[model samples]
Target: MIIIKQYVSIFEPMKKIVVLLIFLAPVLSAQNYTIGNWYDFKKGAISLTFDDGHPSHYNTAIPEMNTRGLVGTFYVNFLWNNSWAIEANDVGHEIANHTKSHDSLSYLSVGELHDEVTAFNQKLENDLGFPIRTFCYPYGNGGESDSVMFYIQDTVAQTHLAARSIAKATDDEHYKYDFALSERDYYQIRTVHMRDSMRSYHEDFRKVISTGGYMTYMFHTIGTPGGWDNMEVDHFTDVLDDLLLIKDTVWIATFRDAICYHRERKTANLTTVYAPFENGNNWVLNLTDSLRDDWFNHPLSIKLEKPTEVVTILSAKQGGIELEYTIVNDSIVFNAIPDNGHIIFDILNCEIPIVDLTVLDETIICTPDSVRLEVNYDSAYSYSWFKDSVKLEADSNVFFAKDSGNYFSEVKLNGCPINTASVGVSISGVCGVPNANFESDVTRQFKDEVITFTSSSTNLQGTETYYWDFGEGSSIEPGYYGPGPMEVSYSTPGEKDVKLTVTGSVSFTDTIKNKIVEIDDFNSCGIYKEDFNGPDFKFWHWCTCKYGYNYTMEFVNKALRLNLTDSIYGEWDNFKLFFYEDSVMKPFDFSDDLYKPVLRVRAKASDTCRASFSLLDTNWVSTAGMKMNQIGYIDLTTKYQEFELDFSNLFFYEWENKVVDSTAVWGIS
Candidate 1:
């Protein structure tokens, strides 16, 4: 409300002034409504938990906590004398399962893990009349195997509300301050050991306060001469005393209660309806959630900012029942039960109308699938959707998004705009489709030359099968899988076809026709020709004698030129130009030919030099070792010239009788 005072006139006799008073209507202001991160809107949270069913826990820890009105979660193994579990449950503390044998779940088989987890749960239900709500890994070891992790996430998660692990969450360095309430894995909740120094605990508490996160302490024994991670009796009492100092701002709870509140608040909804009364306004609060009410009945703390200073009187009620609330620092704070009944509030001398808005879906999704983004819908308020700060055409309360982006919504009420938190959508998956292709080592070669076929297929999404065919009259080399490099040779001299078929999401087949894979007769001179047109080193191999040095070999002027600057073999170094038929040497036969075969070479040299040519056997040994075999030698001049060393013209082709036999030769050098 606004008040105005006006001075009308001033008198001279007694300095009297006439004043006029004016009052105006109250001005409206914006109000913020929020749900506290922790119970009673605490700054941080701590969960006290013990494991291994140590006698010190019941003997020393529980009694000490009971004196301070504190509760803890105790994970007990059935192998020990766990009859004290019922006594722990009788108190306000939580009795959780730590497996029957307390073995590392990662080293256990699938069936053994199932028995270990379910057996403890069954025993707890029979003994305590209720099964365990949360669990702790025996040695903070959930699993490192996919099958075991799957069982814990898919199977064990069904029975337990949440699980705790001493393993670091996300990173190794930040284990002390494990997780914030907004981003924690409920199935694998992270914890810190109690043996860490009190100074470390203080630092962790500070981190929790700053981030509004939860820190869980894992304790095994409470006094000296006890089990693993034992804390002295005095030290344990000091820890409890330290927690009590921050009791107002830090909510210390049992494991089960903490998990229940976190899961409930994650999907809760709060709505406020405003109306005008005689001198003030009325607000009807509706709080609801989507989880099962039987298990998730924990109350959520709500804070409402006072809309105007004129509002002096505040009262709350829910369906003929008075709801207890506090006016702290000029704001109304209360714990409201979800889906119970309407909570009505009456405020006097206030006229502002309030609007409530909240997002319904999760903010982050980690799959390649799409998720629906929804918000609370109301007929009195209009909504506008935006993606990545760009206005979308959607005017409804729900938006179905498949692309990856940041999505948010705006609600317009009483000429004011309110923005809800944004939901980040990320889509991830493989990117391409399967394809099939291949290439042959060479397009044309001799009949006995080896040809290698290699597959150039892409997007082989594991589980695809492959097949290759080198066509008729082809001999396949061994030691290769489907679509792998296959070495094959064409025995017949005609053209042959090669095909590769890949069977997957789409059946793909590629074929190289006979024209592309040509094989000529080895007896023809056409099989032995090298124009040295380009830098393609497909068939020839040049060797320099061991003592020769300072030599260069390259293709120039459409011919292969070898320049030896110096030689150590008396200027008569053995220069052998060997022909490579694919990757292996194959012998060709000309013993039955009507005419004798000839070895020809076009050569030149910077200085006077002699070259020798001979035939090697299948084992790459010189055939000239025998008395009947002979070699061809020639002298080269500076000018390029053609030289021929023809086979001696005599029947039976025996060099001892000056005759030739080509069947024993495998390579020319």
Candidate 2:
């Protein structure tokens, strides 16, 4: 933010410079104007002042401002129990009076007025050891007959510099009166603000600047509101931010400074003197402005044209003290005070050139053959190379590598180092990575099938580890790279993923035929491992082909136990169960699908009798009467053990020719 010089000649109403291509021409005013006799040439001004010192003002608001190096003026209602008002003053904050007892001076008796308004100012001033000039009427009321205003100006607390009113006194005359320091300056200095409208400070500030006058914003008890007339800390700080933005052009100061500046400018005197410099040497100048140093200590800004052919300034001094200066296009600008008397500068020869520079480092790459890195740049620069962050001994644009790592190149221009990266390049190298391919005997078949596997790995060279993952709690530990066929089997399976992996520096994995063989684990054959509860023989009606031996069929112990009692077995006693679904007879068939038909049964019998489950067609009778279909012979035994008979390979012959309908229309017999 630029310092706003309130020099009273704030407006150059008639004089302004209008430049036309390649030429600047100043229009003379016939009269030089200053903005309100100010310190810096600022056109507008503002002050962040709070009223009725609330604890939030001290505890919350001030710290936030202090962090940002800002300060506020607090008008305390001494009668209120707000204990933080004194702390506000202790921190260099301006504390003014909001009146004792906070009585409404608009209607208060003369005696009550003095007690509420006058007494509060003196009491606060005495306690804080700082004279209080700025005042805020309690509840923003100036007594019934101008008592508060009269008191501030005359007898109550003569130490007071200025008092503010919140009546909005928006009348043009009042604004000009306050801004122009007219008769009603103290009582009628109208504020351009609204309650709780801190959010609008940015635009509101523009209004103050447009008016080009002394505009004072009035508030009551900032921080958490003790009443409806208070403001939030965030809301207050928002206004502060708006003030800082124009700190360069707008004069932001305490209410007291506002009154002091006008007084100081009236009495202050200034003069400028310069010491002659040798030809082609330095030039020096001193300026002094005398006012009461303690009260008018605001820094003044000075701008001077750069001397002919002066390249730069080496140093600046004021009263033997070094100061910072900015040399802007044929102009030297600096801030100083009259108290220091004058400023001196040593001119020097210096030329700082401007150039666009960028640096880069190429990332490392891992490949197989060879790696080469190179750079592209202008020849005007001196080149230096680096490898892996270490400055290389060579100064070249290209760096050839026997090993893999990061590399970069730097160029020096006018003794300044500028670095950049190499062009990305890489080659091939070795690290174990193999194609895990394998071959299997068959896929999609019955369960418990042993699948023979043959490894077909490619580019395999390393301390390799081999593994076989048979998708179901089944795994094989890795073996060193070598070996041919590995035998594996699947039991009780569906589609089991038999995956093979060969791991090393770079691991590899693959599955035989991209999918494991799907096995129909007896589930599709209905209930082979079931009791009579399943939908097998329980739902099929049973009858003897020709009853010869005494037979009993019953469900016992959850098992379908067919008993043949004390008799010799004969082929005529064969029992067959008919397949039925809702009384619609359908033949058992698996020839349409892939699973080869198989008959498995658990039986118990003696040497004289044997039981077996087989399939026989109703149309099986031929010239050979009572011919059997596909019948599986069972072994006679007293103990029970299940045995499987693959009827898919079964066939029958009649008259020197094998029956071709072996898989046609079969019932459980």
Candidate 3:
């Protein structure tokens, strides 16, 4: 016995049985069947055909088809001649006929139809030396004065060949004949046409093939339309490429070849059972049987009840044969012919759970001294710890890590791996100190001037140890040991780098360049130059007193008697005065205030270049026998413009006048 089963879902369980018969002959290969006969086979088949002898049949269609090693039938008309018809003789391509004028066959009488088809056939045979066996209705019509059905039957009988028309096939047995033949009651064939660019056609092709059934694709012209019924060449090539990729799983052949192959290969001893389970249903079962051979033997029926059910049907070839039953599920049971060959069903609702991990707290900057890691999990039963790739012994919810590395954790549920998460840890330490210097021209002079040195450092987190090297071969003040302004004396002139080393928790050092100091000692004098005749000489005296030089003289000013006193020195010590009024000095008594004199004193010496001083007091007396002396001198001559006096070292002094009564040597000089 042979049996077959067809299920809606491939997931359903199926079974088959094979029994060897006595005196069976072994076949080596597939048997060849006659051209027009039907064949029965384990799997269904279909053929793809094309029509309309458009120019693309050669240029666009053939080359694309050569890529996939596919060939199709092309029905032509006389209008597509040497000027328009594809050169069919050049390639092993078929060319059939539409009418010579492409007139609707339904409008023509049977005799005229015969003349139209035969004339085109004769033209093709004379040109290509081949008999045309196929014909397509122009405008898809097949009738003339008679009904299309009667016309198709008559045409087939007259031509001693088959004919094909356009119709779709369905599983309904009532429409089987209409779907099977070109005309209602004739042996004519009917087929479906598929355009290359139609998405619906590809989807239908996939659906039919996936159902383990027949699928046919039909095409017309293979290029841009010059008339109706046209398709692009590339579109045709794309379809062929798609089909070739699945050629192993699909049967691709000519229309006539497929019809004949399916008819003769049909099996009577085999049956198929289809069982489609409802949505969310837990179980599905299928059973099949093959009485002829194991290759065709398969389970054809599937049973599905909540707990258990025994399903049976009449054997396709025999009756009253009981198959065995078995308990495969807790409540579900199945039956099979052999005890051990029964189908088993399983309905498991298993799903993988999702796990998510997150950090609850914001991350903190990692340092060499401290680090903390915090994390949280959702839908996670447990976790396995890891650092880098090495697994840690403890699998805790959170981990505190101080070392620098990649930290990861694997989640688990009931000891099964789920997902993993990771974080990176980094470490850092404290910064260090920097240095200072200075330049100057003084080395060792009191000069009453002061210079200072500053200290600096980096990463001084707290109080730092400041070591100041002043380059003076002396240590800093006992109490001063940090960054501050401090004075040091350089009695000589030079350059120096003050080094400051700041050591806190972190140690650092820095140096500052060219701390300079300078000192000098020089003296200058001032004198007055007068342009007077040389031989005629006059005596002039210059003096610098505390206030200035004083000489008493009488003067009359407009009915008033005025007494004038000469003071030579200015308020500052480094100045000199010149007495150049009337070009000469008038003789006057030194002991008595009798000589009125003007004195000029120029600047004598500078006090440290950056120093100044105010006059304290001044007095004037004769240069004779008065024992009066100036701390510095000023000469009245052309070369000595002014007298320069260094009173910076001078202290306070007093002088008095002395005279002999008789001759008066202290008289005017």
Which numbered prediction scores highest in TM-score against the true structure?
A: 1
For residue 1, give model 2's deviation from the true position in Å. Answer: 47
| Better by TM-score, candidate 3 or 1 | 1
lDDT (10s digit) by residue, model 2, range 1-669 = 233233222122211222223224332221111223344657666666776665666667778777766666777775333235556666666777777766666576777767666676678766666666667666556521364455433433233445676656455443331364532354434565546754665776766566655567766555655655677766777777767787777777677666556544443333334432543435555443333354345455555666565565667888788877676667676666545555667664543222232323323323343444555555655777676777777766555654555556776655555456444433223435555677777665445446666767554564556666556522343344343476655566677776666664664432222447666543111222223232332234243433332233333223322332222333322444444444565544433223444444443444444544455533344655544554544544545455655544444334446443333323322
Candidate 1 ranges beyond 4 A from true positions: 1-31, 79-87, 107-112, 143-148, 169-184, 196-199, 273-282, 306-315, 318-322, 346-669
Q: Give the TM-score of candidate 2.
A: 0.39
Candidate 1, lDDT over the whole model: 0.63
User: What is the TM-score of candidate 1?
Assistant: 0.43
TM-score of each: 0.43, 0.39, 0.31
Regarding TM-score, does 1 or 2 come out ahead? 1
Per-residue lDDT over 1-669 for candidate 3, one digit per residue giving the tens place of the 0 to 100 score: 433443231111111233434234332221211111122222334456666666666667766765677756666666423422344434445455655777766677777777777666677666655555556566556622235356544563343233455544444331231233322222335455655447555555565455555545567766776634566666666678777766665656554444433332332221112122232322222232222222122222223233222222211111234343333343222223212132333222322234545544323332434344443555556767788989888667677666667777776555545445577765433433322332223343222235555553333445556565665433343343667666765443444344554555443444333433433221222222333222222333333334445332322221111111122322223332222225654322222212222232322222222222222213233445333333333322212132222222322233453432211111000
Ranking by lDDT: 1, 2, 3
Per-residue lDDT over 1-669 for candidate 1, one digit per residue giving the tens place of the 0 to 100 score = 445664321112111232424346432322577788889988877899998888788889999999988889998887334446666777779998788898988788878888888766877777677657788878777722234465564445656767887764343334333342432266667777786244466666656677677878888877856467778888888888888888898889999888777777876777554442533456666777755565566788888776564354446877657878888887788887776787777655622224333545444333444567777777766788898999999998787776779888887655446677777876532222335678887886556568888878664556656666676778863222677677788888877776666555433333222225888663211123545333222234333444433333333323332322223333443344433234443333333233344545544443545443344332212455543344444455544455665443322333444444333331222
The count of backbone overlaps in candidate 2 is 37
- For model 3, where is the 10-residue window of minimal lDDT? 660-669
